[model samples]
Target: MNHLKIRSQFKYVQHKIEAIDKESFRYNYNVIEGDALMNTLEKISYETKFVAGSDGGSICKSSSKYHAIGDIEIKEEDIKVGKEKALGLFKAVEGYLLANPDAYN
Candidate 1:
């Protein structure tokens, strides 16, 4: 199944969005497309232009839409805690890699 990419960039974006008023949140997403099942990733050799189109942008949001994305719906406390866990994990992993450069191989 397709899962949202876990990256520090996404974490930063989440933190920034959280720091702002949550009530103001409307459009939220980074996924252009994803498969709901396994082995469904768009083939590496294929291109979206062949089927999708020139516009890589998402659909325009309606002002009436008030629903939030699933990832964003996590409890505020959990979001904060999750980021803290992520920060610690990142530091630990990177620190290990830096101390063992050959481990990258």
Candidate 2:
């Protein structure tokens, strides 16, 4: 089996995204702060790539024993839509990794 994870961290005005591989214990994909990180993420094909942010914040769940991204905004009023978008985006990435395990190998 293959394990792919996406972890997100958010502060007052900043957010972070980390891509990890559980099978190989490798966590190297990091989306840094600023528009550059946004640009980098744009290059990747993920379902959540097009989620626009609202005036409020989003929520993210904490990391689990198998898969988790850390604490983030998942609530839309508090950012519920954003949370859904991020999850969708990560899910797409997970699908890609599962379909092409050799790409990581």
Candidate 3:
């Protein structure tokens, strides 16, 4: 597993891979600075699983879990925003994979 650190204008995030295989990937991330940290977000974890589809494609199932700092509660709207961002990233990856079929293999 590898650890990554990302820095941007709005946030500094740390990511640690929990597990990975041909069919699934799992990781946890922490917002260590900026907006999310100021807003009480502790960490976010994600698991993505891929399965073969009927028409020679793949079906992706992804889940995200958010943790708040201390006793603070995260808002539903905020979670929704996170979900949207994740979906966008997924689509971008899918597009790249589709464009270069042998890239991953």
Candidate 4:
């Protein structure tokens, strides 16, 4: 994604995550708060993967699994989730960015 698009996407996820964080704090459940924080981290981690063009053929524009980050293996289930999340986030972000390219500064 482009710079401005990244900013907008960041805001979109950040807002939702902040809401969850607020609830966690209000409940005062240390365990729940930790879990929520980890969930938020997971979201951001997946978001990074989605943004870094690592979701497979679409983002990388190549089918060759030549390079890799680790000994990671891409299973069918993993592929399904990757595609879904990547495509979903892309549509959400790019759609908005297309309509309002200058949304972020």
Candidate 5:
């Protein structure tokens, strides 16, 4: 497994890569020190698999699970915001890959 740390003005995030291969990747992240800590967001786990598409491209299948601290329930709106941010990140990566065809090959 690989570990990464990201620091921003408002948050300190940690990422752990649990598994990776040609077809699948899995990881977990947590905001160790941030505004989210005050809100009880503990961690998030994600898994993504790539499969061959009918059109000779690769299709991505992904899932995310969120964890909350103790008995505090995560709000629906917060979950939606998280999902939207994840989608935006994915789209940005896709755009970069499309622009740089040889990247990560």
Candidate 6:
């Protein structure tokens, strides 16, 4: 994606992820608060396609990045959840980041 598009999508996902982090904080899930989670959320949001193609394949342009992330994979199932799906994907990425800190380091 272009810089503008990436920035816009980052903001969009960041807003949604902040809501999730707020709830996690309220519940004392302090582990959910960090830049790693935010980065993952931004990457997924910028890279994901909310819909699939007619052939049942991803329309997302960052297919290579998606493969690289591995555990943070966004499939058609997540897309089908509509608006709430971003949360699910964010949580998955958070978990992966938490478990694989060296991946980012």
The candidate with the higher TM-score, 3 or 4, is 3
lDDT per residue, candidate 5, 1-105, as tens digits? Answer: 222233334455556676677434433334344564456867677777777799998788878777777888878897787777768768877887787767657
Worst 10-residue lDDT window for candidate 4 reads 27-36
lDDT of 2 by residue, 43-94 (tens): 2211122222375643323321111134432332533444466568767886
User: Which digits, one per residue and each the tens of the lDDT, describe model 6 over residues 23-51?
Assistant: 32221111132343443332333323234
TM-score of each: 0.32, 0.33, 0.71, 0.31, 0.72, 0.25
Error of 3 at 43 (Å): 1.0
List the candidate numbers ranked by TM-score, top first: 5, 3, 2, 1, 4, 6
lDDT comparing candidate 1 with the true structure? 0.35
Clashes of each: 0, 13, 0, 0, 0, 0
For model 4, how does the per-residue alpha-carbon lDDT over 1-105 read when each residue is reduced to its tens digit?
544333222222331222223332221111122222223232222212212344552242212121223554445675566456556766777678677767765
Candidate achieving higher TM-score, 2 or 3: 3
Candidate 3 clashing pairs? Answer: none
lDDT of each: 0.35, 0.42, 0.67, 0.37, 0.66, 0.37
Stretches off by above 4 angstroms in model 5 are 1-10, 23-39
lDDT (tens digit, per residue) of candidate 1 on 1-105: 222234442322211121222354343323223231112322111111112235973232221111234434434564356446545755676567667767676
Candidate 6 Cα RMSD (Å): 17.0
Please give the lDDT score at residue 98 for candidate 3: 78
